[model samples]
Target: MKEIYLVGGAVRDKLLGYPYSEKDWVVVGATPEEMESEGYRPVGKDFPVFLHPETGEEYALARTERKTAPGYSGFVFHTSPDITLKEDLLRRDLTINAIAEDCQGNIFDPYGGRQDLQSRILRHVSDAFSEDPVRVLRVARFAARYHHLGFTLAEETRQLMSSMVQEGEVSHLVPERVWKETERALREPSPHIFVEVLRQCGALAVIMPELDNLFGVPQPKQHHPEVDCGLHCLMALEQARQLSEDSEVLFAALVHDLGKAETPTEELPRHIGHESRSLPLIETLCDRLGVPKKHRELALSVARDHTNCHRAMELRPTTLMQLMQRLDGFRRPQHLEQFLLACEADAKGRTGLEQHPYPQREYVLQALVACNRIQARDVMEEGITGKAIGEALTRKRVSALKQFKQQFTTQDKTQ
Candidate 1:
């Protein structure tokens, strides 16, 4: 008497008329031997999860879990053939994700998932939600994903998340899981909402204290009408959503001003050297969270040089050349684009400045073009043939940039 049901995200998204990417199934009254004999390949290490031979979709056995200790990995699963669909659904994190549908499209929601879905609420399935820490991140990510649809966290669920943070459950999350969730959130339509949700539940302090520290810190009102450093960072992230959908660029924008949180009391409204201060904090956060190399590198570049990027028109030709060389702009033009987008986001993120023009992006781009047009081959053709060739190339690049700057100034005066 085995039955398979479409479950979790597939069923939830289907009910909401939202697009979904993958389908997962829950098999009741089935054993590993039965699935294997039917050509299903066993894949689950800690539980009985098999892949459908034809569709390649995952089909996990209806199972129950009990907390064995603490944290996400502290759960022990019980997968018996007698495990009912209701019992399996009870183990899920959210009511919205616990709904299921049979092959004949029969909806079986032992929980009020359909009701919650229609109400646009994100609620926990049961008190068992407290057992796993990763659910906090998942809930925040869902908030980010569906923020435009007016989805709100249920008050009870928010309380439970806050309790989990207070109980130190979130501290047990592994670095890989944290980075994975953060990276996914960064790609969401309203990614800043993810941070807001985490901060609300007090999870941000445990998971990303560096970011949480920015909340109450002050910034100059003239430069950042938002005033609070954390608010401005989130605002920057929102602006980044308009400029680029790339997660690396968005992440760079989110963390570019982390050093402001560490400023001295004497520097209350003015973060004099916050850019340099941000460098080590960014490195520490990235290292602790096991962030990927590309994300870390981009964040570091934005944190250290975003101010310089904002002042591109004021930098001398030699300084501009040095900036491009530091960014390896000629060898990695795509990375340079990412850097500029992050800087633009930072410049326009302030309150009352969302629509402000940022000419520095074009200035830096033109400067890079001027320097790039001075080819290394042209310099090598002079028979310098050594380290002098490198020096000569630098000289030519600076000279070309200076000429371009002069032309740019002349054109500006004419306008």
Candidate 2:
């Protein structure tokens, strides 16, 4: 009584008309010995999983899991020839992921997954969803991926997530699992929804308290019409998505204003020294989550120098050269572009300002181009040598920036 069926994301995406790359299969009434005898390769470390001989796609045997301890790794899986597809699907995290399709184009959804999908809802399969803390992050990621399709979390599911948080289930998630889900969510079309959904479910407080702390904090209304620091951060993340598809840039934008959360009560809405305060928070968060070095570097740059980027038109030539040096922009020009895009997102993410002009981005780019035109080789060709050579190169770069600024000013006056 062996049966093979398509399962998980491939089946869900196919039904939704969304393009998906990989397909997962489920095998019912099949044991590992039978699978190997049939030429499938054994691969699952925790349960019964195999690889198709020709296609190399994953095929996991129908299994059920039982909670033995805390955290996502505390589960004991039971797979046998008697295990049914419905039992396997019941252990899934969400309803939309529990539906399965046979090779004959027959779908078996014992869990109302099709109804939930059609209704644009992300609902947990059962109360057993609370057994694994990673489901919180997965639900948040799904919300982010399908946000553009008008999907929303079912209220009951949100309540369950909230209960999980209250019962301390979310606290058991490891940093790697949290970051893995977050990185995937960052690549989604509506990444802000990931954070928003987590916040709504109270998981943000447990997983990313630095971000959660921003919600009630207020900012100057005139400058940030969104007013709430967290809302502004989410808006900035959305804006970054519109500007560039780079996840690092989007991450920087999402966290550019994190320092505002630490602003002293006396400062109220001004957040005068929040930029410097943001650096340590960013470093701490990055270290805790094992974020990639590239992401941490860009986030640090945006946190420290984004204000300078916003005021690019007014910064002196020497200051501009120093800014470029700090960003290592002279050697890594693409890094400069990422920094500027994140800054631009921050400037435009405010309420009623989504379409506002950000001339600073182009101005900074032109300044970089101007500085780049004065090559070190050309400077060395001027008979300059020794330690003074670096100094002399800096002077030339500053002069070139000065000229670029003057030309920009002249062009501005003409218009």
Candidate 3:
């Protein structure tokens, strides 16, 4: 008799008590004809996948995959009634992800997935894991998601991933798919692990060479205790998570220092004018990944003005307003908020600074609030017309910001 089983993440999550966000099923000994007769809607283009008539949950037939080409598009799948559950499970990327649970709640873990789960280890199921370049990204993403659980990659699995990277497997992945995995990883609580693991296996060099170049680049020790640009990037990401839950801000924090890697080596440690220099690299990365506009915009603003934000207290009122105008923060206050978080992440990402307070955050935010008070309508009513109104309004906003700065200066004197 044909049977259905809950497979993949649902089974793994249930075993770990992690709460399932999605449940995927595999139908054993089932044909497309049988599935259609039961009213399951066909959905998958490359393989036999059906949506349940009632629940709409995805259920794919037990199948196996083969590598027929170079990249993610190279996969060829074979789904047949003759394929067993073990065969389907073996074709999966990781052992812990290959386990399945039946309707009767009997788990089919032929590959020692359960033991690996108990040990909090992520191990590849078979040599077939090397066939798909995307699996390396998936493994890194899983590491980002599960690092808090103490999950470590198996030594052999890491070796296999290294080999895949050496063989140019990572280079074959499409940019959009790479970004899809990367975006999800950047949103996780410990996103730094994603960057670290990919770098470990050499995938970073292929997928994100600009980021990989940051590894040995040094920063001023006083400002960046982490010293290394790559390590600082990860540190900033960790700090970004604490300041903002937005994935855009997290991504911005990660790329904020990309230009530092390009700083003329003759001027070591000090990354002079790195902020503007980061813009081209950010644009290149965004275009490559087809990153969402929201993420791209936030990252661009952070890359261009993160230093301005870091030195908020020192910027003149005119300069501060220009910075705000450049960021489009007058119309979208959240953009400034995102930029401030990225700057704060950079500030606190260093060693011995994790718990240090960032006064620049409040100072910049207050500057934004003071600038927001100047309205174009109010300026227009002052008999200012045409482009002159814009200039007049800008003057008023700068004046308001000057006053705001003075109040802070006065408060400091009193203290």
Best by lDDT: 1
Model 3 agreement with the true structure over 161-268: per-residue lDDT tens digits: 999999888888999999999989988768999999999999998888888999999988878887999999999999998887789999999998789889998999
What are the lDDT scores of the predictions, listed in order? 0.94, 0.93, 0.90
Candidate 2, 1-415: lDDT as tens digits:
9999999999999999999999999999988999999999999899978999999999999999999999989989999999999999999989999999999999999999999989999999999999999999999999999999999999999999999999999998899889989988988999999999999989998888898999999999999988999999999999999998898999999988789999999899999988899999999899988989999999999999999999889999999999999999988999999999999999999999999999999999999989888877887899998888889999999999989999999999999
Q: What is candidate 3's TM-score against the reference? A: 0.97
Better of 1 and 3 by TM-score: 1
Give per-model TM-scores: 0.98, 0.98, 0.97
lDDT head-to-head 1 vs 3, winner: 1
Can you tell me which runs of candidate 3 are displaced by over 4 Å? Answer: 413-415
Please give the RMSD to the true structure for each candidate, in Å: 1.0, 0.9, 1.3
Error at 370, model 3, angstroms: 1.9
Residue 148 of model 3 has an lDDT of 92
lDDT of 2 at 279: 95
Model 1: number of backbone collisions: 0
Candidate with the larger lDDT of 1 and 2: 1
